[model samples]
Target: MPIVNVQMYSGKNQREKDILAVAIIEDVSKILSVSEEEVMILFTEAPHGK
Candidate 1:
């Protein structure tokens, strides 16, 4: 299993997040030789400039 932790400022909307998550999942799974189900993406959002 591969876990990707993304920490970024909190300003993006749901559509952006969804698109990013899907892209990340696809690339990570392909590069890591893991199934999409085994690839995990965790986002930790914070206030801008925080």
Candidate 2:
């Protein structure tokens, strides 16, 4: 199993996240020669201002 951690600012909407997740999963799966189900995307978001 491959775990992909994505750290970013907490501002993206659900649709944006969905799009990004799909793209990452597709590319990662193809490059790693693994199934899409095996690729996991973890998003850690940081809020703006302290």
Candidate 3:
């Protein structure tokens, strides 16, 4: 399993997060030669400069 961590400022909505998840799954699946379901993504939201 491939674990990916993504950090961003805390202001994104559900749609944006969904879009990012889809895109990340696609690219990671291709790059890692794994299925979309096998890839794991962790989204972290924090204030700027944290």
Candidate 4:
């Protein structure tokens, strides 16, 4: 199982997040020779505030 963690500044809409997730998953699957279902993708959206 391939686990991927992505962190980005919070400002993306739902569509953007969905697109990003799918793109990341596809790339990881191809690189690791694993199915998209087998890959784990995590996105942490953080605000630029204290």
Candidate 5:
């Protein structure tokens, strides 16, 4: 199983997050020769103070 963790400023909407997750999973799956279901993606959203 491949685990992916992505952290960034909290700004994207649900659709964007879904798209990002799918893209990441696909890339990881292809690279690791594993199924998409075997990949785990974790997103950590954080606030950015200006």
Candidate 6:
């Protein structure tokens, strides 16, 4: 199992994040020979401090 943590500035919509998460999970699963369920994804959002 692998834990995927994505940290970025808060701006993207939920749909975009969802799509990216799924894409990452699929690629990680395929390359690691693990099931999608075994891959854990966590997204951390922060302000740009602009």
* Per-residue accuracy of model 3 over 1-50 as CA lDDT, tens digit each: 99989988989998999999999999999998999999988999997674
Where does candidate 5 stray beyond 4 Å?
A: none
Task: In candidate 3, list every pair of residues with a backbone clash.
Answer: none
**What is the C-alpha local distance difference test score of each model?**
0.92, 0.96, 0.92, 0.90, 0.94, 0.97
Error of 5 at 13 (Å): 0.2
lDDT per residue for candidate 5 within 1-50, as digits (tens), equals 89999998999998999999999999999999999999999999999879
What TM-score would every model get versus the actual structure?
0.90, 0.92, 0.88, 0.84, 0.93, 0.94
Give the better candidate number (3 or 6) by lDDT: 6
Query: Pairs clashing in candidate 5?
Result: none
**lDDT of model 5 at position 9:** 96
Tens digit of lDDT per residue, candidate 6, span 1-50?
79999999999999999999999999999999999999999999999896
What is the lDDT for 29 in model 1?
Answer: 90
Compare the candidates by TM-score and give the number of the best one.
Answer: 6
Order candidates by TM-score, high to low.
6, 5, 2, 1, 3, 4
In the range 1-50, model 2's lDDT, one tens digit per residue, is: 99999999999999999999999999999999999999999999998887
| Candidate 6 segments whose C-alpha is farther than 4 A from its true place | none
Clashes of 2: 0
| Candidate 4 global lDDT | 0.90
Candidates 1 and 6: which is better by lDDT?
6
Clashes of 1: 0
Q: Model 4 misses residue 47 by how many Å?
A: 1.0
